[model samples]
Target: MTESFPTVPLDGAPGMPLIGFGTWLMSGSECYEAVRTALDAGYRHLDTAAIYRNEPEVGRALRDSGVDRDEVFVTTKLPPPRADQADQVLAGSLDALGVDAVDLWLVHWPPGGARPDVWERFVAAREAGRARAIGVSNYSLEQVDELTGATGVTPQVNQVSWAPPLYDPAVEAGHRDRGVVLEGYSPFKNTDLGDPVLREVADAHGVTPAQVVLRWHVEHGVVVIPKSATPERIRANLAIDGFSLSDDEVARIDGLAEV
Candidate 1:
């Protein structure tokens, strides 16, 4: 099918959209409406998790959106400390989402000392076709390497809390070297929209700070999933294409990084 959303090719699997709708803090009917609004607003990627306790609602939204299943990319995460139960957890996620298989599946966090076993289970689930693409979240550079080393299966993507203060060039570069894509969650860093710097950029681009931040993520080749429940904001978020930031503008935001 012709792609309805801007896509970033996964290292192994098919392409994923540069921006995805996140359902982290939303729940109940709220999540359903938010996700439905997002889909209506042209968002083709949806990020949810088993622990979020809202998969059923999200699934309902997807079904109600009138969009074809093949056109949308649905991503969900495995609950923490469930290395041994990866298969079962994924099964439940699929059942709740009312999908035969997820487009991408992620480990919410590295299982610390249990990472090796957890990774094994993750690989098994992927191999079983329960998850089309498998990756990790909140994993440091060291942990990413460890998982890849243990399983000999590189992650297709690594979702992390990436913002100006927390962006790590070294880690990003390492993942790139290993052919892993970096997906940024919480791309806004809870920054106020009224912030002067972001506002300035927004004004320059005739867009909002949220757009500037999301655009920055795209410019840097990061896949971003930002959560919002407001219809206007959801529409505004997907309207990030068609603008480009200059090298200096990109650098200015990078300088805002806190060590």
Candidate 2:
């Protein structure tokens, strides 16, 4: 069920899959089965976090899916409390995920003054080969700049909440200026699929509103991770490559940001 996907190159690491599967608000057997479903539906990039408390389930699913270890791009985060103890935190994550190294390891959040110190450790983790790439999430542009200034290393990726309605040119510019990839979470959560614009675009493309939104993110050069427990929706989200939205349609959807 593997499908070809565009990859964003890392400065000195492996390329990341553009479309990733997210695991959040899912746990135990539910999380296990959902991970299996996502893998079966052609998703090669998987996003999880220590705070999510489902790494074992996700790890089990990875082993059970029969997908090659190198073929799949796995990303996990370091909890805020362990930000200063990145080595120990990553060791715990590795044990939880049952892997020696993760493709990407991110600092879940910035904890004020300690952020710089934590970021330095994350950089050390990358240098030590515990993570192929290092980055941060829920970080502001200024914070990102500060980290780079303090450590002399820009993050490979900056993950944030993004959707048609949450589009911000400033954020895009910030990432672009520093060669950081913009990864979007909650791609469909904040969006209303029933909105006239989404529905109209979806109808014209003969696809679902969810697909329209996912396609918009893909076309905009943003990496999107959409979480879903439904099997049909998981497959539908990947079918976005079949349709293309015109510039006018992209703008129309962009207008939703102000609505």
- My TM-score estimates for the predictions, one after another, are 0.95, 0.96
Q: For residues 4-71, could you state the per-residue lDDT of candidate 2 as single tens digits?
A: 68878887676787899999999999899988998887888999999999999999999999987677
RMSD of 2: 1.6
* Per-residue lDDT of candidate 1, residues 43-119 (tens digit): 88999999999999999999999998878888999888666688888889999999988889998987664287787
Can you list the residue pairs that collide in candidate 1? 164-257, 165-258
Candidate 1: residue 222 Cα off by (Å): 0.4
In model 2, what are the clashing residue pairs, if there are any? Answer: none
**After superposing candidate 1, which stretches have Cα over 4 Å from the reference?**
none
- Top candidate on lDDT is 2
Q: Evaluate residue 171 in candidate 1 and report its C-alpha lDDT on the 0 to 100 scale.
A: 80
Question: lDDT per model, in order?
Answer: 0.84, 0.88
Q: After superposition, how far is residue 187 of candidate 1 from its true place, in Å?
A: 1.8
**Candidate 2, which segments miss by more than 4 Å at Cα?**
1-3
